[model samples]
Target chain A: MISIPIGEWFDALINWLKDTFPAFFGAVGTVIDWCISLFETVLSWPHPWVMILVFTGLAWAACGLKKYGLALFSLVGFSLIMGMGLWSHTMHTLALVLASTLLALLIGIPVGIYAGRSEMGERIVRPILDFMQTMPAFVYLIPAVMLFSLGKVPGAIATVIFAMPPCVRLTTLGLRQVPHDVLEASDAFGATPLQQLVKVQLPMALPSILAGVNQTIMLALSMVVIAAMIGAGGLGGQVLRGITQLRIDIGFEGGIAIVILAMYLDRVTHALGSRSARKQ
Target chain B: MSDDQTVIEARGLYKIFGSRVAEAREMVDAGHSRAEILKKTGATTAVVNSSFRIAKRETFVIMGLSGSGKSTLLRLLNRLIEPTYGEILIDGEDISQLGPSALREIRRRKYSMVFQNFGLLPHRDVTENVGFGLEIHNVDESTRRKKSLEAIQVVGLEGYENSPVQSLSGGMQQRVGLARALATDPEILLMDEAFSALDPLIRTQMQDELIELQSRLHKTVVFITHDLDEALKLGDRIVIMKDGIIDQIDTPEGILTNPATEYVATFVENVDRSKVLTAGSVMHRTPALATHKDGPHQAVRTMQHEDLSSLFVVNQNREYVGLVRIDDAIAESKKGGRSLDPILQRDVPTVALSTSLRDMIPLAGSTALPIPVLKEDGVLAGIVTRAALLSALSKESGET
Candidate 1:
């Protein structure tokens, strides 16, 4: 007969989160946000063709041939549709996705490395992640409301939480799964523990870590809808508005847009991950 | 040997598992069998009071079965696992007593290990994998890159620098591992069953590569293997371990010819003694009573070089007659000047055309030199030794 008090439980949950997460990322996030604002300003220049060319080239470099071609077509089509709708919401969503995923990687990878190296860190953090992953999407919207209180920041926060798990889990798993023999060999080769982790373990674990990044991106995309609850306007907000106002056509179109974006991100990130694996 | 000359020295090495290792050792010393002691005290000893020294630049092999602690012994050399009780001195310094940082510095600068699994980093291409150890020492990126490229060439993987390790075959991956070790150019190389995972042909190739590398690099190596043939082929001196104890430590020739104990003898018995036993081993050294020796032909040349030859015939004044052929030596030595092989006395026999004369054996009732007759089998089987013949017959009898 164990009766747990709700207030005590809530306090425990907060304490658990504080203990689990890395403190460095909070500082890193501020700098990253400023950088994102600068990048957005530059991207907003009137000549759209130059930006399109650069993005296409980046896609070509990362994914190569067939995927790059498909991505190019999708980008052109998306631009045409946005032109017809006469809205900049699509561009805003694109910026949000890019900023959030980059931030997720920056925060997730180092924390993953720490968790991988320390058993205690892994034990402390893993259960909290399990809770984060399983919790309803709307639950995060409340914290987004309380803290950032609606807009792009709330959307980004929701995306970060949702997309973060894979990066952490994959990084930890990849580092942990590095062969015992390799570690022994590094030790015998006169490599210090730090050297072994940076040179031996991390490099070997890259493919898997990249896979985690891809998963994190997908999870972050799922949270795009949840972010709309906090009035973050994107395709997800369009869909939410369509549902609330009972406009079937608008909702259906927004759903299609979401699908297109998800597919593009998945292919690009997956290709990037495997490309690194092959280079290694 | 003095401390300076001894590259590796272990004293009172005791690797005891489980909490009550001390109590277990005490019980075992007080007249308990290892099994009884283990049951009573819940401890297992992997290295039991072992001690040895390896000279610099020597190829020292530790040979043992799967559970005999050969790998454990090798691991202890680099302090991968701390010994329950021991001192491991590398170049006169006790490595076992060093701190983690100092131990790491020693590992970075002094030694490198190769594993059977070819533990190349999967995420790194050949050059990157090779450069990893150098990178750890905070070497400049460009220097590490150039050195790693050089190491890749050394292991014959020049074109594979950008190839992922997983894309390579087992043999190629093994080369990457070797290159990774070589990149650091450390003082010692510890190989623990480095070729055991490969196919037989690849194993042989890797062994040859090692021999060639050792000749060039002259790096001190501690090679571990379960295969006696590999041990014989490679070891400058072999340490044969059995059940956590060193059974014998000797040159391959010494171990095969004069095994130290019954355990070692069991291993030596099944081995092809002819291949391992050198010409100097069975050769009978004698005062030169025979003079005026027949012009040394290849037939006589072969007998003269080998230890277990038929006989050396001579005149009363101790002058040499054409050497007595292997089989008819007793009869020919007594009869005086009756040319044994009219053909052999006429011409020198080249060992190159015939397979190793050392490989052949004489059959009972056959003329001693076992004149290798070309066959209805239409092939010329090289001459066999008396030792080979006896061993074959003995094997047959034992089987029956």
Candidate 2:
């Protein structure tokens, strides 16, 4: 039988990449760490009640003037998290999710636009997105730890990889769905390619793009919890601790906290997506 | 926009779509059929050696059925679809040789287009959609607003300017599209099936409004349509296309009276001729006209001698006044009236010389006396009796 030693080759390649790009990887890690800490500081600066009030206001506004149910749900959900004494851990998990989602969008949107504009770009980027999405979430942690070492930074990086595919795929889909006659009209009226994108394509594609953003936030929240196993601190760490010690009480508390946070984020972003689908 | 000067011209244009354009061009030049050329060279020839010049203020229409390359030819004028091998001259500048920025300058300042489906931005209100071209030109916001408002009023959509385009009816949306094109005051207005999507009633109303607007604006217009009637109504000159080739180009009346080919003959063969032929074309000279100087005795004698039941009354200069029937003339003569004025029927129907025979059919049918055809100056030009109208209808009646 023909034997292919893929594992051995991958390890050799990783070792070489680490040796040759020590400064490069360190720089990337510093940037990511800075982003996470920045959010973490802002999140922790205000008192918990003040933060709760802010979230409540955002929920109310996102659901529009008449819809206050989401705001009430947010208020009750955050107060319960505080009552459980898991406030700081929830904040930490939030910082990671926000930073990862921000970074993913920054990179994914431009790639999505390029892929959407050209067939060759889509063909090249599609299979890679498929591979990133389908690979088990736990499989990349070993190499992540080997490369960046155990910290919030590696966890955030892994979270970024896990959550980026939807952002790209949906951006491409949104742009592709623009009517051919609309594009042709823009061209006929002397709009440049850049102008067409900004004035017409982007506006038309916004709802789909917002849907992608909602999906990314949900995926990032899930991946951050999984990142807890690699010494990343948060409610994820508390859940990991409960699992190792066979403490159902601790596990359920951390699980409930994650659920509340996920639901709040999902509702806020979902409201945003649907409201932008049409204009006044 | 100088008179008699060509504003747009195309020379030896050819558009063959596929990889081997050179081979396709060769086959097209060698007179191969489109399908044969496509099979041999994997190319479809969209326009083949087409050329024409549009004069200033001319409503030039390119007309054909679907897949006849009428739309493609319109696109070629603005270089929206580049000609495979040709030079397009606009005001003596060859657009084919101009660089991208130069070409954009021409498009931005001098050319605007209206699309078939309106091609409106659904997210924008009517005013914003109308101002789209001005915004592209980087016009000041105040000026853009003022210009767009003017265009909106021109298209008779004044109150709907602030409404979202999606909320408007299809006809209103199309008006917004037209306003968008006119907002820029471009020298050339390229309309590609602009009114084809509207239902028939709205389409006819729009066509009439366009005719009114054209008389006032006099912009050089290149219009495309598949409907023969629309072409006849709007086009100062019509170019008929078949299989990516120009079959004939002529005035509508010229084409209707004498078709250049069997294909063009078939196109005009089914037309309702009453809609095209004017009263002037069918009217005969007034055989027995009575002048006011002639008394009822003279009028009655002329009518008796001419063997007619009715006689048209005219003044000394031969300007039409009214009609005097034989019975009224006899009664006036019996009463010893001095002139035919007392007995003249002043409320009789009179038609303008330019009114189409279709619109005059009912008037002709309802009146027993001849309908006087008067020129724009009210001079008595001719008269259309029922017999003449029927004869006119019968002579030009084709398939229908």
Candidate 3:
């Protein structure tokens, strides 16, 4: 049987977007590059010991001091990364994750709230979110490369696309799950729609939104190594270098560093979610 | 009593739930059955052509089984549920056509509601929950705090101000809800099954507390409940609903004595009439009352004229003082007493107008003199005799 060539059609569509929206694409790339570099500069500027001190202090404050053990573990992990000479690369990965996470939140939360409030908005956004989540993570880099070209910006852009679904989906779920009686009570007490959203719905949904943020951060971290292929310099690049040059020691160090960073971010963000959950 | 005294008036209110509301309303107006309309156009009428007026400071109750639309009708008054076709006048203003901001203003200044589940914001502490209404209205912070504290005290939740609502028991949470509504100082309160979620003992306590609060606050209340006893206890006048339609609107005594429909009769069938019928309802006009200045001869004439063995004696202001027996009057006459007050028995049984017949039953059984029903100011409003008490009690058992 004769068949239409889907791959050719996809390529033609990407080419058309690149041709037709060059200025739009360029502006987006510049903005993303600026954000990523700003975070990268700030994160890497401090001496490795200073960075370690700051992160350990934050972990101590968030997860508790002597009792939880996360703070002590973070201190040891950071010291090991510094000893391994992967401090700068680890900072770059963190910067990329932070930048993408911030951007995703800025866009995703408001969209999620809109979807939560309106059935039409939900219906329109649900399929798109499903596609974004279900599509192969690598496929995001294809569009990222076409739009922003190869660099940390494209890598960060791809990470945002791959990580944003959970942020939006969970935010929508949290807001939708606010108890109906509470909303009704707010209405009964003469709360304006804006007042209800700010005072009642948002506070109640805060824990869930934080959970979404946690997932977004974790997803962004997972994308770092994949982003390395697009010339995003980080620990991901070290892993890529180790692979291409057949250096098992380099690959193993890079893998260990990623694991350490992942554990730290996951614990900190999970602690934040739990704190808010307890408050609720 | 007067149009000015009517705090809330609903005229031809209807709430039909479905997409084809207009058609459904038309069918309803044309006398189609609720089930038939549902079958035909997938429409459910929540409140059907209900009309009632709540007087100032009156505890108006709307009652029905689940799906009877009593809650919907309560929401209709505050425009929480938009009526399909009707007008609601809150102090002579038609709220049905009010814009959102205007309606919000009314909600802020005039109407507040308490929910069945004690819908306190789980994140807020008790004080914050109580002050939420004031905060929503943008009241000044200090004043909001003070008023909320006062409301909290009013609901007997003084020490729980900083306690999280989730940490509170069901009764305490409901107190927070009550305090929240009370903090607003709104003119009207719409309570949707406000005590139903509490345990039976707590529910009774809350009901009594609410009645006491209403007496002091004088806020017009529209209470919704499925419990008939609750309706009879709290309602100054009650509207019983069935299948989205009002079956009757009457005082508790009127409903008990003359239920307008079989549905309402059945609803009130199991009610302990003695608990509901009050002293004022069962009392007779004072049989023979003598002023303190009346001579013993006059007391005797009054007792003989009314064919009574004794006579109640009141002062010139009609405040009850004592009772004079026939033998005492004759003895006083023989001794030439100028006033019946010297011969009158001061230890007569007396009850306030609001005392329930159930409570007065024992007093009636113990007393030989007719039970004098006093007004709040101690005036002799009426007297309850043993015969009247027995008849009121007998009506319930006799009917069955």
Candidate 4:
């Protein structure tokens, strides 16, 4: 049977995009790079004990755990990463996750709000969101590599693309699920559209939106080792190096550090979400 | 009422729910039934050609069973649901023609609404929820707090100001909703089944509180409900809706006496007529009353003239003192008493003009003399005779 060379065509399309959108892609690369470096610098500045104290204090304050229980739990978790001697690598992974999550939220939330507010926006976004979510996470790296090249920026970009769907989906769901009567009440009170969004919709939808944020953070964390494949240095790079060199000890240590970091992020964000839910 | 006194007037309002509203409206104009239109065009007409005027400071009720569009009409008044075809005038301005911002301005400044489900922001505490309208109006924080506190007090929700709305009971949540609407002090309040979700006891209490609040605030109110008793108790005039069409518009007493349609008659039928019909409604003219200064002979003469045994005795101020019987009058006159006070029986049953027939029934049945219905000043307004009371009760029961 006569067949189209789809792979070749896809390559051509990627090349065309690179050629046509050099400035746009470069600007995105610079911004992502700047954000990642900024977070890495700040997170690395604290000594290990200082970092431990600050994070524990934050967990204690944010979650309001009695007797500093969550803070103590986070202390053990962070200590495990340091004990694995993957402290710098773990911080790099955290910087990557933070950058990607921040970027995803910045882009996703407004788009989600637009989708929530209008039928047309929802119609246009639904299939795109489905495609973005259902596409293999590895597929994102292909475009990421072509557009921004193999580095932390491309890895962060890929992570953002992979992590963003939940933020968008949950934000739309949250806003849409705001009780119809509440919206009607807001409208009857003569609230401006902007006022309604800021004062009523956002506050009411905070729990769901926070859930979306938590999911995005976890998703970005999960992308850490995978993102290491494209020159993004972190605990992910150590795991990748271990895999290529067949070093079981390095891979095990990297894996352990990633798990502890994941557990810490998961607990803290979940606690934050519950606090918002309680307020609601 | 004059146009200036009409705070809200809806003319030819129609709200057809479907994408093909134009076609549905045409079908509606062509006299298609709601079912037929829903079947043919997949359109549900929520409000159909409803027209009514609410006088200033009057509590106008729109009442109907579920799926009857009474709530739809309430939303239509505030332009929350834009009419498919028609105009609503708020203080003589065509709201349907208003742009988004202008409609919003009217909503913020001229009208506030309470919701059936309470519609309190779950994230907000009672004070924040109550102060929402004022916050929307950009009222200063101190003013908002002051006004919201006053409104909270008005709804008897003091000390609950900082409590989260979700933690409150249904009745308390609705109080917050009411307080929110009141905090704005808007000219009009649109309450869409505001207390329907509360338990019956709380609902009745809220209704009484609203009635008491209305007397003091005197804001033009458009209240929606399915409860006929609430309609009767709260409405100065009520519009009964059926299948998106207005079945009748009349005062509670007028609707009870003369239902404009069979649908309205059925609604009136289920209502407790005793609770609705008042003493003044069933009461007859006051019987011949004698002044305390009148001679006992004159009292007997007047009683003899009226061909009765007993008579109501009032002071010169027309204040009811007691009743006098012909036998006593005769005895006193034979005894040569100048004042009829000796013959007066001061313990006759009395009720007020506003007393419901349900309350007066026992008094009317137990009293030997006719029950005297008094005004606020204790003057005899009318008399509810045994025959009159029986006829009124029978008249209502016979209709159903």
Every candidate's DockQ is 0.53, 0.45, 0.76, 0.81
Model 4: fraction of the reference interface contacts it also forms: 0.86
- Over 4 Å off in model 3, which ranges? B30-32, B286-307, B313-343, B376-378, B398-400
Name the candidate, 2 or 4, with the larger DockQ value.
4
Predicted complex 3: DockQ? 0.76
Please give the TM-score that candidate 4 achieves against the real structure. 0.93
Off by over 4 Å in 4: A1-6, A65-70, B1-4, B19-32, B286-307, B310-347, B377-379
If you superpose only chain B onto the true chain B, what TM-score does each candidate give?
0.76, 0.82, 0.91, 0.91
Candidate 3 local lDDT, B1-400, one digit each (tens): 4544988999999999999988998888898989999999899999999988889999999999999999889988888889988899999889899999998998888988999998889999999999999999999999999999999999999888899999999999999999999999999999999999999999999999998998899999999999999999999898899999998999988989889899988878888998998899888874568888889998888778879998888898999999888998999899988887677788887899889988987887787778999999989999988888888888786474
Error of 4 at A104 (Å): 1.3
What are the per-residue Cα lDDT tens digits for candidate 4 across A1-280? 9999998998999999999989998997898999999999999998987898888888898878574777888899888788888899999999999999999999999998999899999999999989988988888888889989898999999899889999998999999999999998888888999999999999888889999999999999998679998989899999998999999999999998888888788888988898989888
Per-residue error at A57 for model 4, in Å?
A: 3.1
Q: Against the true structure, what is model 2's DockQ?
A: 0.45
For candidate 1, the share of real interface contacts preserved is 0.84
For candidate 1, the per-residue lDDT at B274 reads: 49
Question: Which runs in model 2 stand beyond 4 Å of their true positions?
Answer: B1-3, B280-353, B362-392
- What shift in Å separates residue A118 of candidate 3 from its native position after superposition? 1.2
Could you arrange the candidates by lDDT from highest to lowest?
Answer: 3, 2, 4, 1
DockQ of 4: 0.81
Q: What does candidate 1 score in Cα RMSD to the true structure?
A: 7.3
Q: What are the candidates' C-alpha RMSDs?
A: 7.3, 4.2, 2.4, 2.8
The CA-based lDDT of model 2 is what?
0.90
Per-model TM-score versus the true fold: 0.79, 0.88, 0.94, 0.93
Error of 4 at A177 (Å): 1.8
